[model samples]
Target chain A: MLLRLAWRNIWRNKRRSLIVIGSVIVGVIATILMDALQNGMIHQMLFNQINLNVSNVQVHKKGFKDKKDINNFISKPAKVETIIKNQPHVKFYSKRVITFGLLSSTDNSSGVYIYGINPSQEKSVSIISKSIVKGKYLDASDGREIVLSKALAKKLNVTIGDKVVGMANTPSGSIGSDVFRVVGIFKTASSEFDKTTVFIPIVSAQQMLNIPGKIHEFAIITDKYENADIVSKALQKKLGKKYEALSYNEILPLLVLQMDLYKQLLIIVNLIIALALIFGIINAMLMAVYERIREIGVLMAVGMKNSKIFSMILIEALIIGVLGTIFGIIFGYGINALLLSGGIDLRWFAESLSSFGVGAIIYPKISLENFIQIITIIPLVSVVGAMYPALKAIRLEPVSAIRYV
Target chain B: MEIIKCENLQKIYQDNGVPVHALKGINLTINKGEFTVIAGPSGSGKTTLLNLLGALDKPTEGTVYFNGEVLYKKKRRELSRLRLENFGFVFQAYNLIPVLTALENIEFSMMLLGIPEKERREKAITLMEELGIAELANKRPNEMSGGQQQRVAVVRAIVNDPDVVFADEPTANLDSKTGDNLLNLMQEMNEKKQITFIFSSHDKQVMERAKRLLILKDGLLEKDN
Candidate 1:
């Protein structure tokens, strides 16, 4: 009966109730969509990093990560490959001999990290093969053929079939150099990565750098990106002391830190919205209580307990909050579903986004965790907002209230 | 048998730092099954005395007893329980909770007493039938006429079968014919069920129909019969 009374009382002034409900609806929708956008952008950045060349995990021969010296090569490649193949989570692995060298053309010269890759093995581990912009991917049969990023190709003033020389120091302290014809040009989300990296057949790179059968790193892709740390740990434990197995997070600490900072910013945004919503609910409920002063007095005079009165007000606010949250979820999820197909285009901010390795179009991802959290929180906030007004209603003196005009 | 006893009931007010006495040392006793009127002009303490007797307000310098129990000595929560179980009120404005239908208003007091819904509903409908307002059962206070709202208020008061039903100017807002009809209904309930009916009013109809009358002048009891 108290519930019935509360339910009826709210509708007595329909406009006021709707205003409160409207504010809650706005708060819910704002939180949901903001979280979706942020999550989408972060998810894209992480996915691009993993897909490009990082794969899920990387194995370096101990000191190679700190210094890409040709002497720090993996001497026992066969042993590491055997152990990696035994791991259940390993989907694919590519052996690469990586060294920082210089590439020179007739028009320009730039320093680059030349990746010595087996074409067939690299195709399975890196998305560079699929990101070919002008020419075909690297092929095993094409000796002295190189894959250059479009930015690097432009920087060198070269095109497909153009010749460039790659030069690097060998273990014997002498410069070893090779002339290669650019067979492919690719573009990626990050212009920086695109301009600073080049790939060639492992045989040709070993010959050019004067090292044979000496691997530098093995990039491994796991069955799922989320299991990268576990797979990296297991491999690190088995291949102890001689190798360092690093997950995507360990390999890109700055990116991981930025993602964490974004999540914290999201929490702060939600708190601001909640604070504004609390004030809205409190103001509306206080007005409602004051409007019904005489009625409340009559209720008290007729023997309704103060606690009952307090609960009645609280229930009214809860109903308003629940109603608004339901509509907000419907609309929030509706907008997300509509945008999930084509995605929201951030081409307007493409330069800034690509600097962080995020694509132009972003698909908003939904999490049931976020929805469930907001669903429960809105009504609890409504109850909290109503506390003051409910207390005020209970504090009125019945005798004076009955006579209140 | 005495249902209510008041002793030297003094009620004072502070109107802008000056003490205004609404009631001054008036003693009275009301018996069971009595239809009584406390009559006076404006500022004559009629409503103040009624509020004291009904346990709606505390007296300035005295105490009230209901069926030999000290009314004001109990806690505030206990007073609420006492009112729910033993007393009912009819205001001059026909104070039915505007959100509720007439039937709901009539069942409200019984609901506070924790009566079963079916029992309370049946009791409310039966009382509405007795008062001849059963057809207006589903109408809210705004939808009903003044007379109909007041009839609903009266049913709400007595539906709990309280020991006393207090009516403050019950007919002040109605036409003569409607007011008399309301009075006739209360008079019948008082006579048949022995529910004590105490009223504070200046209306001649209420004064003439009372089995006993107490008149007040300038916050003092001037006559009693």
Candidate 2:
């Protein structure tokens, strides 16, 4: 009987209930899309950073990263390569000989970090081979051929087939100089990274620096990002004292910290939305309570306890919560599905987004966890909102309450 | 037999900090099978005396006893339960719950007592048949005529077969004919069931019909005959 009474009480003022439910639906949709959009952008930024440079994890000689000189080459590059290839969940890895050098053309000169890579193995870990915007990429068999970033090429006033000179310190404490033709100019999302780096065949770099059969770093891409830490730990133990392994998170701590801060800010945003909903619902419920003051007195006079009255009002609030939540979840799912399928395109502002290292197209992700979390949160808001009104209903004195207008 | 006793009962109203006594030391006793009325003009404390006797309000200077148990000393929850199990009420304005139908109003108190749905419905239907309102069972308060709503209110008051029924200006909203019919119905029920009935009214016809009448003047009991 209380359930029937509660259910009927909710619809007595149809327009007010509808307005509250509408606001709840709008809030749910807004939170869903906003969360997804933020996730999409941040996920893309992390992904780009990982693929462009970090991969999932990296293995480096003890001192190679701290000092980019050729003297800090890996102790046994072949042995480490064979061990990694045999490890479980290891998708692909590319060995690279790295050095910092000054590259000069007839017109200009700029400081550049040069990577000497095997053309075949590098493709599995990154899309560098596919980012070629001008001329052809270097072949493993070809020496004295280099790929320069478009921004770096422009800065040096060089193009495909233009001759450039590179100078770096060799392991023997002698200056190594080589003349090379810029075989390709690539454009990645990051203009800064593009302008500061160049790539050449591994053999050419080893020969130029007078260091044979040596490489500085091994970039490993795992089957999934979740496996990165596990593989890094395993590789660190397997590779022993010769090398150190680090996951993408360790390699990019600042980005990880920024993502964590963003998640906390989203929580604050959700709380603010809940507070707004509480304010909106409390007024409507209070009005319902006041309008039925005499009715409450009648109930009490007939032996209905204050606790029973409290339960009745709470049940009414619960009905509103159920109604609003049903609509809100459905609408949120519909919007999430649409966005997930046809990603929101920000191609018009691609240049600006690229500077932040995020992709132009974004597909918002709504996990089951987030959906459940949001649904759970909304009902609590309803209960909290209805408490004050329910208490007022219970506090009525039957004799005088009957006289209340 | 259940008995209600009121000794030197007084009720004071504080309006804008000025104390006005509504009941001034009334001594009264009511028995189980009596049909009683408290009659007076406006500001004569008829309603106030009824409210105090029914355990709906407290007295300022005296005590009310229900079957040797002090009414004023019981907690609010206890008093509410006492009313739920032992008393029923019919008000002047046909105050049926607007959301409920005639049958639901009849079943309201029984429902509060945790009566089973099948049994409560059966009891409600039997009472509706007795009152010639069986056909109006599903009709809401607004859809019914004033006489019909008042009849429904009377049915609701006695539905629980309570030991006492308090009717305050029960026929104020009804026409003379409907009021007479309702009074006859109450008289018949009081005789047949031997359940006590108490009323607070200024109507002359109602005062004449009462088996016992308590009249008040200027917040003091003037006569009990």
Candidate 3:
């Protein structure tokens, strides 16, 4: 009977009930959309940073990460490649020898990190072949050819089919210089990488550095990202401590930290909206109590207990909360689907997002946990918010209430 | 055979720093199966005395004994139980829950007593019929006439078969004709069911039909007839 009374009372003032439910729905929808956008942007950014920039796992010599000395190159590359190839989860692997060098042209000279990779194997591990915007990527038959970023090529006043001189320090403490033809101009979405990196053939790098069969790192790719840790750990245990295995997560700790901060900011915003919704609900319920003062008095005089009155008000709040949450979920997902299909182009903020390795276009994506949390939290907040008004209504005296308008 | 006995019942009120005595050392006794009317003009403490006897309010300096138990000394829950099980009230405004239909209003009391639905419905329907408002059972309070609403209020009060039915100006909102009819109906119920009816009213017609009348003036009983 009390539940029936509460159900009837909710519809008595349709506009007021809608206002309360509307506030809650707005909060829930905002929370869901914000969560989806943040998670999606983070996922896209991480995918680009890991798959295009860094491989799932990179094998480097122990103690070489802090100091990239020329002497730290793997002396036995064939044996290490044999073990890595035998791993069932390994989809693609390549050897890269990286070193800091100076590239000089007629007008300018700047420091650059030169990556020496096997052209055929590099395509299996990284997307560098697809990123070539001008000329062509280096091939096995193309001797002494290099690929320079568009920004770096422009700064050095060199283009495709131009000659550039690379100078670097060898393990013997001698300066080695080599002339290479720029065969390709690469344009990555990231400006920092485009300005600093130059790629050359692995055989050419080995001859210039005087390390005939040595490479600095083996970059491995796996089909599943979650398998990165497992493969890395298995390789570490099998190869002992001679080689260090690094996953993308360990290589990009700063990105992980930034994602955490973004998630925290989203949570704070969600809480503020939830608090506003709770206040709106409480206000509506207080008005409802005031308007039904006489009715409450009659119930009390007719022997309805104070607790029953309190529960009835709470029940009304619960109903409003549940209905609002359902509608909010639908609205939130609908808006998310619309925005996801028609991607949000942040071209105006392209520089800002690209600095963090994220694309200008963001797509919203929601997980099961986010949906479950929204479904549970809205109703709980409603019930908790109803406590004050319910207690106030219960404290009213029968005689005084009967006189209220 | 006294159902309600009050000894030295006192109630005081503070009116802008001056103490106004509402009930001053009053003593009264009423027997079972009686139609007792407490008659007084405005500010004569009739409602205050009725509130004490109905267990709705406590006396400031005295005790009220009902059915051999000290009503004032009981705990709040016990006082509520006493009101639910023994006392029924009809106020001047009718006090029918505006959201509920007349039938639901009568069943409200029975519901609080934890009466099952079938029994509560049967009793409420019979009481509404006895009050001659069965046809108005489905009508809300605002949809009904003043006399019809008051009759619904009467049905709600007596639905639980309470030991005593207390009404404070039960006919003040009705016309004289309806008021006379209501009073005669109460008198007939009192004679037929042998249930006690105690009311505080200024209506002369209500006082005339009472089997026993107590008139108050200046917070003291002026006459007992």
Best by DockQ: 2
Using TM-score as the measure, what is the rank order of every candidate, best first? 1, 2, 3
Per-residue CA lDDT of candidate 1, range B1-225, in tens? 999999999999899999999998999999999999999898899998988888888999888999999899988899888888899899999889998999999888898888999999998998898789999999999999999999999988888888899999999999989999999999988988899999999999899999999999999999998
**lDDT by candidate, in order shown:** 0.90, 0.86, 0.84
Q: Write the per-residue lDDT of candidate 3 for residues A254-342, one digit (tens) a residue.
A: 87787778767766776677678788878989988988888787676666778888899999999999999999999999888876656
Residue pairs with backbone overlap in model 1:
none
- Model 2 - which docking category? medium
Candidate 2 chain B, run of 10 with poorest lDDT? B86-95
Chain B TM (all candidates): 0.98, 0.97, 0.97
- What's the lDDT for residue A401 in model 2? 79
- Per residue, candidate 2 scores C-alpha lDDT tens digits across A109-215 of 99988888889888888778888999988787348999999888889999988999988889888989899999998988766678788898888888888778888
Best candidate (score: TM-score): 1
Worst 10 residues of 2 chain A by lDDT: A365-374
Tens digits of per-residue lDDT for model 1 on A1-405?
888998999898999999899899888988898888888888888888888878899998997777888899988899999999999899999999888899999999999999999989998998999999998888992399999999899999999999999998898989989999999999888877888899999989889888888889999999988899999999999999888999999988888998888777776777678778889989999999999998999998898888889999999999998998998888888877876646889899988888889888987876565677688788888999999999999998888888988
Measured with C-alpha atoms, the lDDT of residue A206 in candidate 3 is: 85
Query: What DockQ does every candidate get?
Result: 0.73, 0.76, 0.41
